[model samples]
Every structure is written in C-alpha cells, then in structure tokens.
Target: MSSPLFTSVHVGGRQATHRVVMAPMTRARSTQPGDVPNAMNARYYSQRASAALIVTEATQVSPQGKGYSFTPGIYSPEQIAGWRLVTEAVHAEGGRIFAQLWHVGRMSHADFHNGDLPVAPSAVAFEGKIWKVDPATGKGEMVDCPTPRALDRDEIRDIVSDFRRAARNAIDAGFDGVEIHGANGYLVDQFLRTTSNVRTDEYGGSRENRLRFLKELVCEVAAEVGANRTAIRLAPFLTARGMACPDILPTILEAVEFLEAQQVAYVHLVEADWDDAPQFTEEFRRQVRARFRGTIIVAGNYDVERANWVLQHGYADLVAFGRPFVANPDLPARLAQGLPIADFDPATLFGGQDHGYTDYSPMQQAA
Candidate 1:
C-alpha cells in the first residue's frame, strides 16, 4: 500500500511530488552584519531539497523586523541576491521552495537591531529573554525585550505594505511561493491575539477586527503573487513565550473561515510545540478539517507513523518535519524505508558549523 504522505498533490497550482514537507527551522547561520545568505546556507538548503516542499528558515522582511542574530533577511538587494543562490540550488534538485516571511514584533531586543527598539501591535513587553547578536564578538547573547510601541493606523498600513513588498521580493529571489509568518507569536500572531493587541481601533477589539490585518495581508500578497502561489502559517493553539490565544477553537475557526474566503493555497498550522503539552486536541483537528477548504499542513514532533496516521485519518494533507528534517537531510527516504531516525543534538541547533547542520549521514549513505 502507498502512503498518502508519498502521494503527489497540488499546492498553489504546482504539483508536489510528495506530501512530506520540510518545516522552516531557523539555523542562525547567516553571514554577519548585513544578515546575508551565504554559500554554506545555500548548501544547507540544497542538501534538504529532497522534501516534497521546503520552506526556508524565517526570513525577516525588514531590519526592524529582526529578532535573532545571524538569521537571514529578504528586504534588501544584497539579501535578495544571497537568497537567489539558495533558490537556484533547490531548483537544480527539482524541488519546490517557499520563503517564510517573518517579523519578530516585540519579541526582540535592541541589540539585535542596532539599538533600535522592537515594534509590535501594542506597547507591551514579553516576559522572556530575546537572543541577540553581540556587537563586539558577533555571538548570540540573551537580552531582555523592551516595551514596544503600539503601531498606529498609519504604521499598520506600512506594515501591511511591507508584507506585500516582501512577497514580491520572494518571487524575485526565485521562491515558488511565499508563506506569511503568522505563527509562533510573531507580528501577525501578535495582532491576532487579544493578549498582545490592546487597541480599540479597527485592527483590534473584536475577532473580526483583530483578524483584519492578516486578511488584508493575505489579500494583498495574493494579488501580487496570485492566490495559488500564496500560503500562511499560524500557531493556532500555541502559548509559548508569553503568547496565548484565548478561545483557541473559535479563533482558529474564524481564521479558517477567513482563509477559505480568500482562496489561499494552504494554511500551515503549528498545532503544538514538540514539548509534551496538550496544544492540539483531536476535536480541534477534526474542526480544522471540517472548516478549512484548502490543503492543510501540520507540524510539531511528527514521525513517520504519526504522519501516516494523520493523513490516513484525513487530519491533514501533509506533515512537516522540523528537527527530524534538520538532522536527517534525507528524511523522506528514511521514512519510506522505515529506518531508525537519528537524534538531533540540541546544543548545536542554533549557530553551529556543518557538524550538525549538514553532516548527518543517510541510511544508505552510512551503510
């Protein structure tokens, strides 16, 4: 019997050879100062091009949008050029790739942005430490996030335009499509959650208004890249790093309704973190399948058995693997053969060299 995970499916008008996706995991290995993608980064992505679809690490749209040190960006000409090399390499492997456009919102420290204060939907500070780049040693440093300024009406408009421009730039960088980074309590998620957005304006105070920015962003970006080539990611029930969305089901249902109305390519959901927390319930999964009309992609601590189970039960159309794909470059082949998976070293997950990034041997290659 053939696994649905290995079956071909169409996403945004492009036919994917399989249903296994490489979920975007930030490696923090970008070249310094300008935050440009380099040959090493290109090789890393190219090596994992075997996935049916590869969503690159979250790339910030602008400098102020940055949160972590050494992560790449897509807002400048140099950054675009650097990403071009990565996209070209993946294309050479006959794989589809999408750029996860991101902004950290208030989840950043000034040290990461050259002493500029981080911005969010409201003037709220998260009770967590943000990782920053040391100006002197160019190393990762833990810094406290400062209070952010609430984006006014005009500022909100500019942010929406930034997303549109970023989507256009992703096309120029040779990505098959763009995935709006609405997950993990980023800018879009900040606005979506009432805990972060305290405004009484049109962008807040009601479920419809809170989701307005995301809807507009999707509509605008889809216009630039076409609805078939646009996707969005959301951490629907995530509550990490001082982020929480009350009434998760209703909020998610509302989001699904909005996405269905927009006719997006797909909605990627990070149902839960890998940790043992009850983030996504079976009822929620069924509700998503019932409400969402397009392709559904689910990520979070998923192995081959779980991936097959979800697809077989119609919970999701695809399963994205994060750490597994990072450690095992040939993750699809390993799953296909039911090979024992390798464990990823958490210590080398962030800013390491090629040791853990690209040195994982495939089952056949190792044998």
Candidate 2:
C-alpha cells in the first residue's frame, strides 16, 4: 500500500510533492573564519532534495547568537551569498527549503563572544557541555557553558529585532521560508520554561509573560517575512537541556493560540525520540490540532509506519525524519519502495569532509 506520506501537500504557497520533510540537523561543515555556507553544503542538501521540505540546520541570527563553531549564519552578506549556493542547489533539484533561524542564548561558551559572557533570559547555567571548535587545534569538541548574563529589557527588544533581520536575510539567501528555533532550550525556549526564566518583569513570571518573548519575536519576524512564510518549532517534553517544568504543556498551547492568531504556516512539534523518553498521549495531539489551525508537523524519531499512522489520523500534516535523512539522501524514495536504508556514522556526523557528509548515496546508486 502506498503511504499517505508520499502524497502532495501545500505548505504555505509551495506545493510539496511528498509529506516527508528532511528536518534540520546541524553538521559543522561550514568554512571557518566567516562561518559561511559553501558548495559542499550545497551538494549535501541538494542530494537530499527529494524530501518535501528541507529545513536547514539551526543558523545563528547574529555573532552573539552563535553557540557553536563553524555553524552557518544568515547575518552577513557573505553568509547570504554562501547560502545562496545551497538554496539554488536544492531548487535545482525541485526541493523546498527553509532556514531554521537560531539563537543559542545561555547554551553557549564565552569564546565566541570575545571573552564576554553569553546572554540569556536569566543569569542561569545550562549545566552541560556544548559543541565548540577549538581555537588551537581547530577541531570541534564539547565544551562547558558558562553562566550567562540575563538580557536587559531593552536588550531583549534588540535580540527580537535580530530575529526579524535574520528572517529577512534568509529570504535574501533564497530560502522559501524561515523556522524560528524556539525549541531545544535555546533562547526562546529559555524564556518559555519557568526553570530557566525566573524573572518578575513583563517578559516573565506568568505563562503569558513567558510567551511574550517568543510572541514578539515571531510577530516581528512574521511582519518582516509574511506569516505565511514564517514557522516555529516547539518541544513540549524535552528536558535534555534542563528545561523540564510542570506548566510547559500549557505554555506551548498558549503559544500555539497566538501562532494561529498570526496564521503562521505551521507549528513543528518535537517529541522525544529515544525509547526511554516520555511519550505524549494522543489527547495532546488532539489538543494541539484544536489550538493551531494551519498545519501541524511532527518530528523526533518517526519512521514510515508511525508517520503514516499520524498523518492518517489527522494529527500531523507532515512528518520529519531526522537521522534517516542524515543517512539516506533519497529518503522519500526509500520509504516509497521499501528499500533498505543505511545507518549514519556518528563519529563523522559533525565537522567532517565528504566521508559522512555527501558520500552516502542511495542503495541503488551505491550498487
């Protein structure tokens, strides 16, 4: 039987030929010094152009928004020119792509900030290691994050403006749309959770207050780039970044209400992937659909069968395959033909040449 995943769907004005989206996964393969996208990045994305949508890995909106080394940015003219190659390549293969705009916030080290502290919603530490490129060795490695300085109210507005500028820059770089990286305990997620945001100001305290930062950021971004071309990713139960809270679900629903009010293109729900991770109930899915009116996309370790089930059940409009896309560039075809898929090499997953980058071809192509 043909899966519903292979059916066409409309995301905003673009017509996606398949429902399988290649979710954004960061591979630190950009050129150094400027951290710009290059032809190699273009080749990698263009190869996987079969997916209905390709969300580019989390891109830093500004120098201060950067969390790790070698990740691409959309802030500079050079970066925009560089990303043009990737977008053109994807378009050449008839693929749709979106830039996942990111600001790491407290999940950052001081090395990228000229020895200054990283900025966040609060002066809290994330309590884990973040990936950074070694200045001396010029290699990517895990490094501890320092205690971040909280963003002043004025500074908060500036950061939101940065997101708006990034969205405009992304359009110039040839992206079809932009996905605000509000998930994974990043800048916006920090403000959403009570554990990270303990502020008593207008930007924090209550759920609506915590939702202010994200709301303002998305609103400004959508204003700059029409709401039809704007999207946001949210992780309701992800505590890996020490962002666990009791009220996170309600806050997510509240944010969805605003997002629907803005008529955003879609809301990407990132659930836990591992077997040990908590699974959200079907009731939650119904709740999300009730709140958001546009499209709902679901990610986190989804396979063809499970993705088909959700799409058939009217829970999600699209299914994003992360690691599978990492390994199988022809992921949609592989699912359609029920062909054997390859497993990715984790060691070469980040900061590598062509070994694990673009070398992985389809089973037929390899044979």
Candidate RMSDs in Å, in order, are: 1.6, 1.1
lDDT, candidate 2, at 54? 91
TM-score per candidate, in order?
0.95, 0.98
Q: What lDDT score is found at residue 348 in candidate 2?
A: 88
| Candidate 1: clashing residue pairs, number | 0
Candidate 2 TM-score to native? 0.98
Lowest lDDT sum, 10 consecutive residues, model 1, at 240-249
For each candidate, the alpha-carbon lDDT, in order, equals: 0.85, 0.90
Q: Residues 147-216, candidate 2, lDDT per residue (tens digit)?
A: 8999999999998989999999999988999999989889999999999998989988999899999999
Clashes per model (N, Cα, C within 3 A)? 0, 0
Model 2 lDDT at residue 317: 97
Candidate 1 Cα misplacement greater than 4 A, ranges: none
What's the CA error at residue 48 for candidate 2, in Å? 0.8
- lDDT of candidate 1 over 322-364, digit per residue (tens): 9888778888888887888888888778886788887877777
